[model samples]
Target: SADETLAHLQAALKRRRRLSDQAQMLVRKAMAYIHSHYTHPLTRQDIAHYVGMSEDYLTHCFRQELGTTPVEYLNRYRVLQARHLLAESDKSITNIALEVGFSSSSYFSRVFRKEVGQSPEEYRRLKQSSVR
Candidate 1:
């Protein structure tokens, strides 16, 4: 009785661990797609298709593994690319925004400020001053 119950619990645990690993693999695939394509316009449907999962499942796995939505992750990735350009390039903020897949400079600035705590121009100036 007790022994049988213990065996069942162990088997369930093993199955859960296996499923967790599989889910993590799917999330990694999704992330790879995002990293490669973050410079283009993308949607959750696109990511789901690339990862061979339904959109809702992809979203669930991504959030479970990464603790953020796919769109937020994409925005953060773009912001990081923008940061690199700001520090090293002479491109205007608008050009950099568009270069990084942002449809509008204002939206890019808004996301940048939310993520980096500074406007793009201010960030660039601060970075430049620190380097010099």
Candidate 2:
């Protein structure tokens, strides 16, 4: 009886592992879609539709895989792009913000500061000065 119970547990564990792997793949697909479209206006609903999952389930899967919401991921991606633009381009902060899909310069600055520990202008100055 103990051996039978152990076999049942092993089978259940294997099924769970397989399902977890599938869920992880779906989350990765969602992430890939987000990365490709990060410069566009996107919402969780849109991501959910693209991933063919309900919004709640998508959120659960994303959080399970990435430990952050999709919106947070998108915002972080935008901030990263803004950082690159800040360091390499002479574009104004507002333009960079818009280019990176932030709705407003102020919002972009706020998010950038929250994510990067500096305003875009300060970041640019620091990075540019280091190059010379």
Model 2 residue pairs with clashes: none
Q: lDDT of all the models against the reference?
A: 0.82, 0.81
Best by lDDT: 1
Cα lDDT of model 2 by residue, 1-132, tens digit? 234234433544454343476776676677778778878889999999998989999888766655578898789878877888999999999999999998999999999999999999999999999999
Per-residue CA lDDT of model 1 for 26-114, tens digit only, reads 77777778778988999999999988889888878766656578788788888988999999999999999999999999999999999
Against the hidden true structure, what lDDT does model 1 obtain?
Answer: 0.82
Q: Looking at candidate 2, what is the lDDT of residue 42?
A: 91
Error of 2 at 25 (Å): 1.1
Task: Supply the TM-score for candidate 1.
Answer: 0.84
For model 2 the local lDDT of residue 30 reads 75
